[model samples]
Target: MFFIYSFTADTPPNICITGPYKTWRAVIPADTHSLSPVLYCSGCEDHVSVSADQPNSQMETDEPQSFFAAFCQLLFKSVRYICIYIIEFFTGPKQSLKGNHSDNKVNLVLLGMSGTGKSASGNTILGRRQFVSRTSSVPVTTECQVEETEINGTCVCVIDTPDIFDDEIESSVKNQHVTKCKQLLQSGPCVFLLVIQVSRFTDLERDILRKLEKAFGSKAKEQTVILFTRGEDLQCADMNLEDFLQDCNSDLKNIVDQCGRRCVVFENKTSHKHQVTKLMQKVDEMLNKQQNQ
Candidate 1:
């Protein structure tokens, strides 16, 4: 005869079965997060009494020793699979987590439409004019550029990409930009800074996020931070960044939510080192949370 049962760790395994046939009970460890139903069967062997405390005691069976070894192997394989599932549940997305930790550096990729102050934001973060930022009728940065600096005791490498999301741009040209961006990603943990102008959320800006997802896959936003430039707009209205976000349109809110609500504001015109410092703090927080998971 055979019997099967399941119980949580907190429950006392006080099961006692008696019959003319031999009886075997399998008790799962308490530390396991989940309980899988286990079956035990009596075999042609002498009857031996077992107590609840002695869960690991071997049950006499006329079956070959190899049969027991095979059963143990299958049980361990199931436990290992469960462990991997639990780990993936806690760690949300992996796009931002891939990198060699030995080379401690963070890659900050600046991406957005033309005239969105991406270059200026890069300059502000680096505390110097590393990229050409100027008022122009056309996209100032026609290619991807990179620069490095030390921020808050961490090495930061910023990549400035052109307005590759423009529909008018040829697909071949956009492919080239994408290729260059991938080549520039040979640093440590990376995060994309999706820059946009404050108080000027255009229709194109609304759709640019969708395009970003198409180009970088659905997990793109997991490693992305929505950076709103021209912070003076908020200051002039006596509103903080959160306050502004609370009143913004749903499109922007959805974008922020997709990125795990990781957003920051930067007044590129000002030289306030504190602003850069605050943004870096958000970046570090994201890194820490991802690493812990």
Candidate 2:
């Protein structure tokens, strides 16, 4: 036996199924919208009328109509849902001007103590003088600043923050800076570039990870990467970063381990684009790992 179920208005009947048992076919007119083609093998004498509403309601059947009736009900529901999905897809509510996908930016924030090359690293990442970076004995960045550019088709927003947690900076000013940093990153995903001088990790920075966790919750380490500035130090040592870190002190190793061993090196004085590409790749890998979790 065979059966056909036609859905379209002008097209020929669509062959639905074939079986060895005798079958019955219900032909619905194109103009009629009440009941579409519904086929039942044994029970064809009585019409199975289905309302446009309540398509999944129990059908009148003496035999087991679970398969056939459920199929018909599912077909009706699928058509209705597909129509709704299409309508909503085209005429759905508009995204907020601020919440648009183009605004799905990623913030790469430079965070560390004073004189750790945070500002210079920001300039290196942006590939321009977005922040003031000069030979200054004092910290140049006094307030939180941000600059944006596109990288790998993603809007990369780099935020330069002052040495807020430094003892020289006032507590009230640090509080305000922290608030502003949160505001800048509230709209999108953010990763912390814990910038530090290659050979100049101070005791103050030993507790820097603790401070970050206290301020941004314990997950801060998960989103952080140890950015060793002044790659020349490693070059002068005649060693690559991985070898240097392996022989590095326990404190530095602890910091790296806390951040899931995520680390990258940068030479702010150089114009090497490959370094930026590699760093961005590490950032993407970190983000992907977080998402999978």
Worst 10 residues of 1 by lDDT: 45-54
TM-score per model over all chains = 0.64, 0.66
| Number of the predicted model whose TM-score against the real structure is largest | 2
**What tens digits encode model 1's per-residue C-alpha lDDT throughout 1-293?**
33343333345232223344445444433333453323244473332222222346453434544444344435434444443354344442444322312335889999998999999999999889989999999888988999998764568899999987888899899889988987988558888899988788877777777788777777777778889999998999999989988999899888787788888899988999988877877777777777767
Q: For each candidate, what is the lDDT?
A: 0.71, 0.73
lDDT of 2 at 263: 86
| Model 2 regions more than 4 Å off | 1-104
- lDDT value for model 1: 0.71
Using lDDT as the measure, the top candidate is: 2
lDDT (10s digit) by residue, model 2, range 164-219: 65766677888898889888874667899999888887877778888888767788
Query: lDDT score, residue 155, model 2?
Result: 79
